[model samples]
Target: MPPRVLHFKSIYLNRSETFIDRLIRHLQRYDPIVATLFPKHYTENLPIYTPSGWWAWRRDCWLKQLNRTPRFLYGLCRRLQPALVHAHFGLDGYRLIGLARKTGLPLVVSFYGHDVSRLPDAAGWQRRYQRLALQGTRFIAATEAMKQQLLRLGFPETRIAVVRFGLDLHQFAFQARHQAGPRLLLVGRLVEKKGHAVALEAVARLHALGIEARLSCLGDGPLRNALKEKAQKLGIADRVLFYGEVTNEQVHDAYYTHDVLLVPSQTATDGDQEGLPNVLIEGLACGIPVIATRHAGIPELVQHESTGLLVPEGDAEALAAAILRLMETPGLVARLSYAGRLAVEQLHSLERMVGDVEAVYDDVLKCIP
Candidate 1:
């Protein structure tokens, strides 16, 4: 029988966290179950443990009021008998550090984007992370850039492993898009780091250049109103369509309808950055040409006119030019499309991610007597 691994996330499954679900679901060599502080209702199909309704209220009370570990969680860990605990984020790992010590289970923590870049800036987090770093058996980062952040956080160099989110090629099949006009797609939560405002400026610039390019933005966030206002002010609101949040199927289908995938991600004012946008990988897998900014792990994937076109982060003029270049040059688009698909196939397949993840688990388990 395969060894059981407990997957811990503060929130079981947010709509934007499908990648975490993929990791939990695609483990072939290990039995996986979820333990979240609050599990989403849609997660009923999975083997998960969470305090619901009044029980959850009581759990919060225990955590905040009495300042003690919830007996429910303590008991759940004992009952489930998982060989190791894999926490999804640095904050969640900090929350579970005490529990792991009490249960005497090896803990593996994954730092994706904001957790490594943004969380360290918070007051008291550095000290908290130092504790987690010392206690955690292994750490997973999405890129070498993120690994550097972990290194600065005092994580042992030997314990940190760089793992990319694997894209399922069969799910995101390549399709040659032969659209009438330039239909640009930006798929991410409307946020500072996502650079939605920059994308709007680029679209506005395209219009100013006499190119009638339409922009479709998928997903929504706190900046939704601000981004809509910015688009309206730019006078490109007529050409911009904000679909808010949509299902994964809708996003996949949107890729086929659009001409270019725009990933204008940047470092936020609060120091938040991207690990690597899965949309970039998904768009590349779909064989759509992508125009992204040179930020974080983005450059690691987009090799500037090789796999896809890249621009300086927060530079609207440069982004508009990249889009214009793609519009005027069909050969460039086709070349990028072919290379992008090939790159994702070789570097970011789900099979490869699962094998790498399980290999880490195997190494962590080997240390056990």
Candidate 2:
């Protein structure tokens, strides 16, 4: 009989939704029983438990409720009796570890960037929760940098595996370049860490240089008003268009419609940085050249000058120069776009990610005896 795996995540929204949902669908191919913490409208063969109603609370109360989630999760695990429990982030892992200890089941945890960098600095219980989460389970780091952080936090090097997130190549196929005006796209939360300000500044500089380009901003967050103000102050608000929170299908369309994908991610005031934004891979997959910074896991996915151009974080001038170079060069975009698509197809395929995760699951299960 195939092994049964229960994947636990707090919220099935945005990127987490894409990752968990895709993993569940693929794992079904191996005949594994998939389970999640969030309840869905449809019961499509996957087991889901609507636990403790944590998703309904505000941020502070949510963290407080998460601190007391072990009892509820323990009951769910006992009822499901999964062969192994895989939690997507560290805090969820900490909760699962408590259940694992009670039921004697193996637990696997994945650490995405913000959980290790930003959450620990939030004070009080969040820091303690992260510490306990790191201490208890076999950890999966999304990047080598994250793996190093896990090791520094006292997890055994052998206990941590670096598994970068994967992309669906088919869904993001390369589209032929068209003369649809010189368009730049930024797709991510309008938060400080994502460096939307830097992107706006770069566009402002390009405009000052007499470059006529259209900028499209996708996604939304707290800094939306501030970013718009910044763009207007720079006298380029007319050229910059904010699309707000677009659906996944719209994101793919934006990628193909734009000339370049700009991801000027930086380490925020709280040390929050990206763990390889999916937009970079998705942009490249759509045959669009990218101009991103060498921050966090970005370099892991974008080969400098091969797949896309890289600039120093927060350096608007460098970003402007890269954008200008891509625009001025007639065929560089095509070359980089082709190379980027090939890179994603060869290395960042969803199948590759699921296979590595399955190996991790199998390894943890073997040590259970």
Candidate 3:
């Protein structure tokens, strides 16, 4: 019989999708029964959805709702009876760990930045719950740096594995540059951490320097209208195009049509940050040179001066300078584009990520017997 692995996540937002979806889509390759919480548009051959209310709470009700999740998750696991459970974030990890202890199934959890960093700061019980989650499950780190964070959090080194997120190389392969326009693309939520305001400020700087460039903003959030107002105030509204909440296919097309991908992410005031934005890897895979901030897990993917240019977080002037450098320098774009694509092909392919994940599953399963 094939091994069964249950995957758990809360909400299934378009921007929040990642390699987990890719793994679910290709589960037959690993012969595992993949299960997920939260409903999404169906993909053929993947396991059916198991509903969970882990992420439907507003800020005011989150604490009360979170307290009830462990019971709900335990009930879900009792019904599914899987060999192993993989939770996608630390909070979900806590819930799964509780279920694992109740059901005697092996459990694994992935830490994706904000959950580990910001969620732990909530209150005494939440902090204790975070520790409990880390203690009960095998931890999957997206970067070596994240692994170290887990170590410092008192997790046993033996229980942690560093497995960076991967990309579909076939989907994001390098293609010939087709457009003549200087297009700068930013693909992320229009929120404070994503630094859409920084991108707008940088574009304003570029306009002041008399550089003709168009900026395309993708993805949507609560701050979308505010960001648009900021762009108008900066007098670069005409140059900025807001293509909010685009599909994955549209995102791939944007990668090819644009000359450069800008990811000006910053550590938010509440300590939220980017956990290696998949779009950087996707853009690099599509052979588009990226200009991103030297923040969070980004440096692990973008080799400074090789794959793409890195500027200090929240520095619009430096961002503008980097963007101008990529636009003005002939042959530099081609060199960086080729190097970025090669880096993704060699280091960030889905095969490599899945292989690492399977190894972790094997180790966890061995511990079960």
Candidate 4:
């Protein structure tokens, strides 16, 4: 039997964090049970451990200041006897470092975007991360760009591993797009880093150019109202349909129905950025040609004019031009779609990511005395 692994995320899951669910689901060599502070979206009904009641939560908070594991968490470790703990986000890594130390288990932390870019600036988190850098056994980066970010945060060079976001190709299966006009799909939370406002402006620009471009936004966020207002201000509110949050199945259906996929991500005002948006991979895998910004790790996958089109981040005019180019050029869409699908299949397959992650687990566990 495979060794049990404790997978920690502050939240059991969220709509945008399907990658975490996929990782825990597809892992072959490790039996993963989730541990979270707040639990939601447990449709899989996996084994979950959480502190129950306000007293338990308050006590855990008091314990953290002393650099001690929450008593409940310590008990859970004693009961489960997981060989290692894998924290999904850097913030959780910092939160659980004490628990890991108490259990004497190797802790592997996956640093997804905002946790590296924005979270450290929150009050005392920088110092907390410095301690995490010292105590965490291994760090997983989704891109070389994120690896540099982790190094800047003081993670050990030898212990950092780059693992690309993986996709189930079968789920996002390829479909040849041959449509008229433009039907654009932008998937991701309506947030600053996602650059939804820029996408709105671009859609408006296309409308002004006598191009009938319609955009459908999947996923929701705190910025939804602001984005809707911006779309109204841009006079493209009708052209932009906000589906808010939808199921993974619905998103896959959108990819198949839509002709173009837009990922206009940029650095948020708070310094939040993307490691690599899995939406781009899903779009590519579904053979929907993508147009993205040259921001963070996006260029690593989009590859400008090869796998997909890339515009300068936050450049509405440039984004409009990219959309117009796609609208005018059918062969470009077919070429990019084929190349993008091939790229993901070669480098970002679910099997490839699972194998790489298990290798990281193996490398970390080898140091056990």
Candidate 5:
């Protein structure tokens, strides 16, 4: 019986599976069992979709979680006898602090983009995050920007670790792109921080320059209808295709098929931003030129005019220029293509990121009381 980690997520996204699936694949090699809190995902205080049915849950489950949350979670932890508990997001971690105390299991909380960015600005958010930092035994920051944000929130530096979201290198095959047209691809939810609206406006700007470019949006969110309306009004609706959501296979295929990938990320109105958009790395892996903004830790990967072009946030004009530059520049595509793949291997490879995570897990478990 090897160690176990009871991974907790308040609600999981049905579209893009959380980091749990990826982490489980890698961490399973050590014979650790990873379990989830919401046996199936729940949204808006309701079970979104559950094939097995919620009633199938053990009778003890309710008795464990009924009166006291910490006591209930502690009983579950003791019954499962996991060595540790790993929670993603600051809010979730804060919620489980009592469970950690009651169970005497080390808790590792990972702070992703919005968890450390926009979340801390919410009412009473700072105090909650600070409490989580103090109670959590270990912390993982997806990027340097996230690490800095954690420090600013009063988290001890010694407790924080950097482990980026990684991609399977072998999954994304690199094809040296010598020639392609201005066909732009936008990946991620159609949210303000993802800059999908800005990408559409940039496509319109490219149209104004007489460059008949086609833009494909891969992923959907609340802004879907509104963005579609804006594109129609801009008259670029004919050129832009909105793909609501897609499988990983489809997204990987699009990365290779598209001429260039646009990840024009920016700070949203609520102060939400990215740590480092994975699409930039995936585009690089597919050997396509990526045009992203200097938002958060993006510069850590997409260096301006080196691996890919970096544009100013919300500047459709600059983004348009970058799209055209990649199309017209000879040998430029090939150069960035090679450089980008190398960056992923050296920085964001799944194998290495998994090793880093395993190391943290091992270290935490070793010191457990």
Candidate 6:
């Protein structure tokens, strides 16, 4: 029989997250993946649960039986008899750990961003991660910084694998960057850590320096309204364009149109931080100069004017200065663009990343007694 893999996600598939979507699709290349999620009637491959509430109709049956998991989920796992249970997100693995124990199946959990950076510091999160770290078969961290962070939190270093989020470079066609009027682009959810407001402040500083530039934000979240208001208050409302909730094609188009990408990631008050934002890598892949703040794993990507420009987080003056420098020096921009693309092509290839993930699965399966 072919090796079947059961994938679990706390939420349904979100196409806006290109990396998540790409990872799911790539995993299917090696094995028959059955993505089980709380479905809103989505997908052609798998739709195990529906939004109509799995427990709304089965509460009485659940109370009678002392199973922590729903009857249908346990039955589904027994029938599939998957070789491995791969759960997305560090926190989401909390649910899968119990299921793995109940079924004697090994669970492999992948920690992206908040699950390692911020969630670990939250109330009761320490115990949760400790249990998963000790109980789960293996863990995957997208960046070495995150892996170290997990290790400091007492996660077994041997059990954690570092597989960065990679992209199919062929999909994002790169072109030479030329001198333009600083078309600055920022693509991420409108949140505190994303630094959308800081990007706007930087744009206003550019206007003050007599450098004409337009800023565009492509993503929507809880802070969209606040960011819009901040733009208006800065008096650069006319210079800024907010494209809330854009499609993947639209994001790619923006990368081609813009000269530079701004990623001023910072640590939130709640301790949330970045785990290598996909937009930064995507921008580099498109051959555009990226000016990301030196926060979290950003330094790993932007090596101080080597691959891309690095600036201090939340420093509007510094962010503005970097943007101005890129605009004034076309040669520097072109150099960084070429070097950045090469770095990604050589280091973060999609095929290599998928192979690394498959290696983890192979080792986990082989270790099972």
Best by lDDT: 4
lDDT by residue (tens digit), candidate 2, 75-128 = 666776678777777766765655677777777888888877776667664556
Better of 1 and 4 by lDDT: 4
The residue pairs that clash in candidate 2, if any, are: none
Residue 59 local lDDT, model 1: 68
Candidate 6 lDDT, 138-229, residue by residue in tens = 99999989999999878999999999887999998888786545688999888899998889999999888778989989989999889889
Off-target runs (Cα >4 Å) in candidate 5 are 37-72
Tens-place lDDT per residue, model 5, 1-369, is 667677665545444554445665666435444333455432333212221335534432453344113334555566667778887677778877878877678899987788888988988888877778778899999888889988999999998899987888787888888865867899999899999888888888888878889999999899999999999999999999999987777888898778988899999999998877767777897798888998999998888878988999999999888888888886888788888889888898888778888889988977865
Candidate 4 is scored at a TM of: 0.95
RMSD of 1: 2.0
Q: 4 or 6, which is superior by lDDT?
A: 4
Q: Give one digit per residue, the lDDT tens place, for model 3 in 321-353.
A: 988887777577777888888888888888888
Better of 1 and 3 by lDDT: 1
Candidate 3 root-mean-square deviation in Å: 3.5
Q: What ranking emerges by lDDT with the best candidate at the front?
A: 4, 1, 6, 5, 3, 2
Model 6: lDDT of residue 165: 85
Please give the TM-score that candidate 6 achieves against the real structure.
0.92
Off by over 4 Å in 4: 52-54, 61-68, 178-180
Where is the poorest 10-residue window by lDDT in model 3?
A: 55-64
The TM-score between candidate 2 and the true structure equals 0.90
Residue 199 in model 4: lDDT: 91
Candidate 5 residue 117 C-alpha distance from true site, Å: 1.0
